[model samples]
Target: MIRITKSIISIFLLLSCFTTVVRAADFKPLPQWMKTAVFYQIYPQSFKDTNGDGIGDIQGIIEKLDYVKWLGCNVIWLNPCFESAFQDAGYDVINFYKVAHRYGTNDDLKRLFDEAHKRKMKVCLDLVAGHTSIESSWFKASQKNEKNAYSDRYIWTNDSTIKPEKFVSGKFERNGTYMKNFFDCQPALNYGYGQPDPKCPWEEPVTAEGPQSTRKELMNIMDYWMEMGCDGFRVDMAGSLVKKDPDLKETTNLWAEIRTHFQDKFPEGILLAEWGKPQQAIKVGFMMDFIIHLRNSGYDTMFFNKTGTYRRDTCYFDIKGNGSPDFFIKNLTTQLCAAGNDGYICIPTANHDFQRPCCGERNTVPQLKTVMTFLMNLPGIPLVYYGDEIGMRFIDGLPNKEGSQLTKGNRAGSRTPMQWDSSDNAGFSSGNNSSLYLPIDPSASRPTVEQEKKDPSSLLLFTKELIALRGKYAALGNRGEIKFLQSKDNQYPLIYERRLGKEAFIIVINPSGKDVSVSLDYDRVVQKVFPVLNSSKHKIIDYKNKQLKISAEPLSYGIFQIY
Candidate 1:
């Protein structure tokens, strides 16, 4: 028994070493442009209007390319401009090849691409790979009782008698019911499940002819967009492509195949996954994956958590909040270690699916600045939502517009029209107020880019400064190595070090409502201190004894460069 135990231990150690070596060798370099690229997510419907149509169009985005450039974002991620049925917004894609008429024509989108390229900026469109609208031509052909070329494009059970759970049935003349990915308007495409049950003849394997054809069609769609000068796609629900993928090995393999082919044709083109599991997504050749709000992946605890409410959550960046950094740090560290040099873990301020940073109780400039500091200085690509820089509040209790219905919360609050100015409809539209996409913020004190751009102390200017700082310092970019130096003690402050080769910088944040002092080991001479909003309130009281005493006021942050 003792001999067996020793042998098992030896095998375990050998496997551990082998795994580490394999992971190190398997690292795939991300696209050259992504290393320093800052992404700005644009919700086109609410961005701007050019024709007084009350809806933002492709021309609107084209006209505002300068504004996006001024915001310091090199990459623009447009949320689903594809032709859709608008049931789940653009997620219910009806035509993959055409741009939505509400936005513009195919030529208009192409012009937007050319305009963006002229500014030396890249664009990534949202690709919904897992599903399509029930109204799509493919689905129309699929619903027919007669067999056809596109019959196997979507998932269907054996017969109408055998109804599958969580699926829609009886609406089509086809013998079987089709599976739904999200809303009933969207039907899941048949990529084939990883595991096929013998009893279920409809459960196709990944290698089957039908699934292989689906994969080819998806590639064709990607190829069509790539030829149009689009940089790449921010794939939606990337992990859900292959149903019943228990370990996600099949899904990973599927993406791996696509990556292998995609890289050959478009070397500069990159793929960003919305998959929250970066560990698996990176392994499967995705250049980057988002650490989204789904599954409480520490993102919720950091900024979205609301304190003293029925929700009973704490937001770490809130001034009067009691949120902890332990949860966020642990998850972030694990993901970073796993990612290594393979890909980035994008940290977004907020997305269309969630509330903005300046929402609810955390609407102060100090809170916004501190949060932006943390996002900009972190070791990943920083994604800023459209209106977040101007401190747009997530307007609550707005009725659902463009399928923003979800049980978690009203996403309409976050999808409100971008406040461009203080003019009628906040300058987002010229059409009648009743025809606007979503009503502009009704609050008299609603923030606007025009108002904030004039104020030196506004969140917009502060955000611009932070973006400029990130661009100026290599140690603060996504490629930098991060180390959490002092975050265990909640009373002290949140501190971390970012190192890029020989360059190093220390970042400190005091989110509490009280003054806090922390000791740091900084024997070397301190370089210039970047002036944040409240830098005057932070100071180094003592520099002797090889230990530096740093004091920060409530809801303040500072970045210290080290020689």
Candidate 2:
């Protein structure tokens, strides 16, 4: 009887373990399409104008769909196109349901969705959930003295006499002042605080009636777009909701609930967060998140540091720069472990909020090529900001347009109009130059896609080759495992191996102005040396004694397929 009981107990334990493993594995299956997707982020104001309105619109995006497809990106992350006052550059949304007049009607955007789908591509629109413009009907209704359904839609103090810091007052006839998420024109939506203060009766908890209703409305807004063929949303300031929560637990729970409902209805729908903390965001059920320029998540060390003016002393991308990859590698490893196999960590070349790869000191074609090599081969999803492929320079010292002025210098330079050719307004618009969204790069050497397309050895062509290489190798795709190989020397050349099941590939990059070599215990035979642009100087020195010696020229990179 004792022996029989022991056997049954062991069997029950095994079954319990098996169930736990299965449940954990099924936490959230990442969308298969996202595993190998290359994202292109389009700043609608500067991408391309079709109707000579000087501002890029949905029809313009449709016109440039072929151009995006040619660049090898399978997904598009378009910036905010909702009706807005253009304060904070469309981040201040005025209406949740209406399309901005400057962009086009709702039908035009839907047509873009249809056209993108025909080309086998996906589109994710920017969803700003934390705040709304002062012109928003919700905000306007909340501002009225009389009580209404929208009165509690925004964060407001109870007493009309007290004005909070970083909040707007006097404009609203309501009893209390409202908080601002970003610019003064943008008011924070009341998602409710994690811990409500007893003294402040107006500080509602997450479980309050108003907060619950707000969550429902947010979900409804998402449903409306998902039904229109939108693939998903790249949530703006995703972590900013659920105020007064230092730990972000309440915010995470809020997103998790939303994600659960969203996935149930649209299983393939992707949710990407702007939150820099991947560890927190991934756990909250986000499919992916970016290491944006908002904070120093080791991204600034590899690219241009915006804290200072253009200088060769700062960025790792520049040949003469003194920047190091140690910081980036350290932060990335932590984020990768936190994300595990559940979500992706996106590394962007340059977003609308930061300087491009060819900006500042890293303005040379060879330097740009080396940077592109690193970007395309990284283990995460690669995001190419609209004009970055052709090496667009950030025009410095332009007047602020659409609330480009922020605490971190004016972003007007990075928000300049896209350069298509040398035509009037750089082919961005036929409208008057004064009416253009932002001034074009005035340099005589401004790089244009039309001119670069004719040149076989241009940066544009090189970017295309890198994209092709990434697609050709399964090991270089988003789901592949990456291991950083130790370099014989300190910093010049960085080596890493990418493995996907049975197949493995090695990538070596030298982002310096001098030649560098590394020795590795790679005894396998080199099947192929994938051609890298401007890397003709790279060569395999020796592969004997169970050790391989490889050298790369200044600003060059190489990929070796091993067998």
Candidate 3:
């Protein structure tokens, strides 16, 4: 018995070593453009209105391409513009082949890709792969009483009476009940279950014909767009495809297949997953994934903790300075180690689903600038949501539109129309207030692009300056190596070194309302001070005895080059 146990241990050790070696060797180089790519996320319905119909459209996006380029973003992550029922925003896709009529035609979308590429920029469309609108033609054919090609396109129970969890029945004519992904309007596609139970005869294996057909259709849809100049996709709910995928083994394999297909056809096309788990997402073949507002991912702990998500109001960037970077740092290191050079972890200022950096207590320019400094200096790709660059406030109590109200919170606040200028509808549209898609910020002091563009010290200009600084130095870009140089006890006045070859820069941040100082080891450096971003006063107090002392004022940050 002892001998058998010893043999088992040996086998386990061998397998662990083999797994490590496989992971180390499996990483493929990311696209050349992705290394320095900065993404600008645009919610199409809120960006701009070309014909003054009150809803932002593809032509509007086309007209604003120059503005996007001017903002120093080389990639545009456009939210779903597909045909939809306007339920759950544009997430409940009705047709993958057509753009929503309210937005424009497919030709207009094609033109958007053309225009973006002409400006040396790329556009990534939002791909909602997990589910489709109940109004979709595929779902319509699937719900028919007779068996047809699309009869099994979506998941359905064996009998109408056998209603499983999250199942919807009695509305469709089909004899079997169907499963929903989120809302009643969105039905889950048949990607098949990772673990099919023998007792549940309705559960289909991943190798089933229905799932294979669905995979083929997904490939066809992607090919259709890529053939027409579309760059890539930001796959929504990427990990939510296969059912019962607790380990995500089957789901990863599914994406691996898709990755293989894309590599052969459109080698330069990228795939950014909304998986949130960077470790698993990178292994699943996504070029990038988000460190989003998941339970323990530490995103909320760093920025806005309005709902007490993770650690509550004690955000790392809060003026209170009550939050610690330990949680965020741990998660970040784990993901970075897993990713290595394979993929990037995108950290956005704010997305459509959450409050921007300028919301709530972090409304002041000094506070916003500190947050921007930390985010922009980080090692991975930086994503700036539409109005976040201009410090747009997240308005509360707005009426829900297109299913913006959810269990998480009312997303309508973040989905408000962009405040471009002081014109009618804030230059978003020429339509009357009643005809507008959503109400504009009623605050007279609400920041606008026009007003901020004229102010050199405005947050909008600061954001642009930060992006340009990032572009100016290789050590500040996405793939640069970063080393934290702060002392162990105090996490305030966060200090870090970004070095690539001979190019090195030290960045310091003090988010609290009170001043803070930190001592760092600088044995190998000569001090020649040049401030790249000094939002508030930052000074090198002393450089004596091989220890460099630096102090920053309240809510201030600075980037210094070491000579």
Candidate 4:
């Protein structure tokens, strides 16, 4: 008997050793403290105003850190605090090391980072390595002469006769005559800076191929920010990094190099790529972006990819005479969930460049709550848009223009300021309220944070609750497998099952109006139900007698436990 007991103990020790090695070799995730923690995204200009400069600054973020923490988020993903011309809301970065004077100094960022760490939250910086601002000194230097070292740092194409075949798809008029820019003035890096524009003669063509020196330069840019005490990088335009180029091996390899370099210093630096190609991108030791897959998969049946989606206020239908409501959100939500199945995702509802989701009431409180639950609860990292929590709407009253600003897309309404209070200027700053960076979201007062906190049903309060709930489950934020569950009703309601070892989560959401009833099949396991959401608490949310009946409210969701 004693010999048998010793044999069991020996096996246990062997298993423990194997498990420890596996854990260490694998990505040791950010502390579980961030698992159920929510992230509050802040657009420096809109979150709060420290000085009366009519702009939000780092001091303002520092001041509001407590409020953000109180909102139940341990991870904070700031849009872009780096110095920029404010074109595309600082996405067009000019300097990686320096914080823009408009936002604050390097000290302010240091202070903010310190404060966030004290709160036990993880912070990720938005890395815009995709493209630097055209006005950036690098571009300036490269454009100055065709012989400068900086000239080869950016992608500039010469050979005015050859056009990137993809560039001629109605978006740009190219008979190999005019050089097209992504945002007109913003020249797409020719991969090599000194190279003349492939369609023009002003600059020499430089292929994105760096041989070796250019990789060193990009490494320097990445190292600069990580050394500034950043926790991770959210690689921008990840898929676009190797675009229309026959040799994408060089670009993807560059990402692998960046991953290897930073992972050494910050072992868990959260290397998340915005690259949507999961098969290739995920294997490269970085997380993937997942929107294209969602729409195609039809997380919900009402929408047919982005094709079925259109604005509710002014939706035009095909001859079918019907429109899908916020079908795009299904794309976004399932995108996060699917990616979570593989790697991490930099999930944000609306960023600077795109039109805001809440423009002209794309979201109601119930709808917003459902979306928040979907966003935070889905696997991957949740990136909150600057003002999405309070249901900040956009205002596109301005006429479309032909210049640098977000003139065409529904961008004006999305970048609106945070509705801090019900006071004039939404308490963003003491500066002249009329001189806001972007116009105040029109329907803000009814759904403001102050009002939401008081009413449990408000969107702001719902956001706080969702973030808090996410903290309770480790699988929600990490490597959990997603099994898309089918709803009994084939209407707008879509359901999916998630299995993370012993923890199983059922997410049921309806992105459109019109109630639907469905039954869920949890054939295998008996469950232990825990409270993850506030709105709906159905005591027995598990399968009984081999069946689970679910009644979903219009434009709402219920998170369930199937232990």
lDDT of each: 0.81, 0.80, 0.84, 0.57
Best by lDDT: 3
Candidate 3: clashing pairs of residues: none
Provide TM-scores for the models.
Answer: 0.92, 0.91, 0.94, 0.75
Better of 1 and 2 by TM-score: 1
Q: Model 1: C-alpha RMSD to truth? A: 3.3
Candidate 4 lDDT (Cα, 0 to 1): 0.57
Candidate 3 is scored at a TM of 0.94
Superposed Cα RMSD, model 3: 2.5
Candidates 3 and 4: which is better by TM-score?
A: 3
Q: How many clashing pairs per prediction, in order? A: 0, 0, 0, 30
Off by over 4 Å in 3: 1-28, 307-311, 428-437, 441-443, 522-524, 537-541
Local error of candidate 3 at 198, Å? 1.0
Clashes of 4: 30
Model 2: residue 343 alpha-carbon error in angstroms: 0.8
Candidate 1, backbone clash total: 0
Per-residue alpha-carbon lDDT of candidate 3 for residues 1-563, written as tens digits (9 for 90 to 100): 99999999999989965664465346445679998899999999898877776788899899889988998999999999999998988999999999999899999998899889899999999999989999999999998888988887899997899998999896677888988988999999999999989888767888998898999999999999999999999998898889998767688779878987886899889999998888888887898999988647988878875641122556889888887887788798789888888889998988987777876677888888888888889888999999888988777667778887777577777877888876665555455533335556455678888889999889899999999988999999998888877766878888888989988888888888887877777766566757776665436445677777888788888888877
